[model samples]
Target: MKQFLILAIIVLSIAQIVARPVEYSDGNDDVLAPEPEPTEIPIGKYLLFTTKANWIEATKQCRSKNMKLISILSEEDNDNVVKVIKAAGEGRIGFWTSGNRRKTNGVYFWGNEKKITYTNWEAGKPDNVRSNNGEEEQCIEIMGLNILKWNYRFCSNELYFICEEPHESIDETQPISLLFAQQILTVQMFGYYENNENEEVLTPEPEPEPLYDLVKKYHIFTTRVSWADAMRHCQSEGLQLVNILSKEDNDNVIQAIKDANQGEIGFWTSGSRTNNNGTYVWGNGQPLTFTDWENGVPDNLHAHTGYGQEECIELKGYHILKWNDHLCSYRLYYICEENTKQNLFSK
Candidate 1:
């Protein structure tokens, strides 16, 4: 009877083990999965202030931070700024840059006294439109409208601003651990993912080529002619009047002229404000993205009697290839750019 009781007890224990529900978890219940790291704006090398302040106050704030107002000297710098602004989720807001023309109207320069070589101006911007109280729109801001473009606003207007660390303070020989931290932050902010330890990592896609090459060949015409005549001649030769769009293009044109043994002589470019509402544009109707104007130029001065408005652009060798506004009827040598592959193939 005792043996039978022992067998029944064993059977009961077996039945309990089989019938009871077994809870299985990958430590999700007892051990909380580490709270995810909160998303933050990747500042990189910039300091973004969400609070609004006037241009003067913004400059003071940046100075207090031991930094300076942001100066975007290249397209990459501008893109990084846009990314930070977008991350902040501010729509239709403008941010103050270091650009200001308060010292000399219509001549924008950064805090470092460097002329703004790269520009992304909005249509009809930097108009220098005066306010009702006669306040000039001399301060530049990056507008977050349809696209990230620049617009000059009243210096007293309150707006968000960006500040940049001085290049001298940046140490390229940072510790490896700091670099790893930066990489992790980048992965988190940019949505980069990693494979599991056992899984094979996929290769990244190659970056796309730039839309246009910065370098271009040019054809210099030594014959002096009016801007209108130069345009006609270039069109007849299956080329377009050279449109200097960037510093690289300007340097290339200067070198090309030197290669032709041309001395320090002025050359007419495709830029002109003739009948364009006081704005300059290339013969192809494209707006100017870059400019190298000399000090106190484009003054629209009627230097010569009986000459029309100073509506044409000339690369004056006297100014070391700086641009100057001259009368359209003034005869000068010109440059013509080769037809692009797309243009040639299309023709």
Candidate 2:
């Protein structure tokens, strides 16, 4: 009976060995395998996407994950997001945020139309720098050596992004022994599991969105054309030449011009004089009560010679956005106003 018991014990031991879990190791033969690192570290209510993309592209990509691009609403939220980016070994690359301009010279509103009560612009940022032919920096991006500073850039520029969704319930029954292994596996499945230094992202970023909704519904025609042709172009598109009726209106228009970063070139408005000595009238005939002519401008001088025939008004963006008089036949960039009546804040 003792010999029989010994034989049974040996059989059981052999079976246990066959059914045991395989030992995990780094394959160094000397060191045991370390616990797997988590694929995602909970930071605030977001998951920082390590993949890079433009602002518009990032927005759609995040939405596909049932999340939205990270909108830094407060200092606390900003710090939390920065932490997550760092943990992902992506602090060096900046992430796209949800802030964008609603109107030219207008305050930036978040994607959900949240007021920008909090901002962390890098010193002298949101500069809206648009070179002579460069595009406007309308989209906000969080990029710096430290990963918290921010600056505005053209929405088409590509960069890493963060996506935030409501946190789901955590499973309390999960064993601690399996947590690390699951994390590593989950990250690997994301196709972005980079061992940090060797991280290789395999998943492609979300697709791009059209550039229409990223800015105000206004259009700036960089093509120089005679005032008559400019008016015709606007009419063709159901638009009209811009009419600056008030200081606020002028501010908005000038902001658009600056945002275009088309340099200090001239843009024709709807104001023009019937004759050199007659009053200037808006294209819409609203009234000639408002004017933004530069000091000593509308001199109505025809090229500094001959009769005073500078009949049309052009806003020179480079000259402190001041207005000047030019021949109606002179070619220049123009602003077109659409007839859409939607509320600006509806988005």
lDDT of 2 at 52: 66
Global Cα RMSD, each model:
26.2, 21.6
Could you tell me the lDDT of residue 337 within candidate 2? 83
**Residue by residue across 127-237, what tens digits does model 1's lDDT show?**
877654345677789985636689988776788888888666433221101001001111101112357766533233333121121235699988899999999999999
Off by over 4 Å in 1: 1-215, 303-306, 342-347
Listed in order, each prediction's TM-score against the native is: 0.38, 0.39
Q: How high a TM-score does candidate 1 get?
A: 0.38
lDDT of 1 at 160: 81
Candidate 1 worst ten-residue window by lDDT: 175-184
After TM-score superposition, the amount by which residue 300's alpha carbon in candidate 2 deviates from its true location, in angstroms, is 41
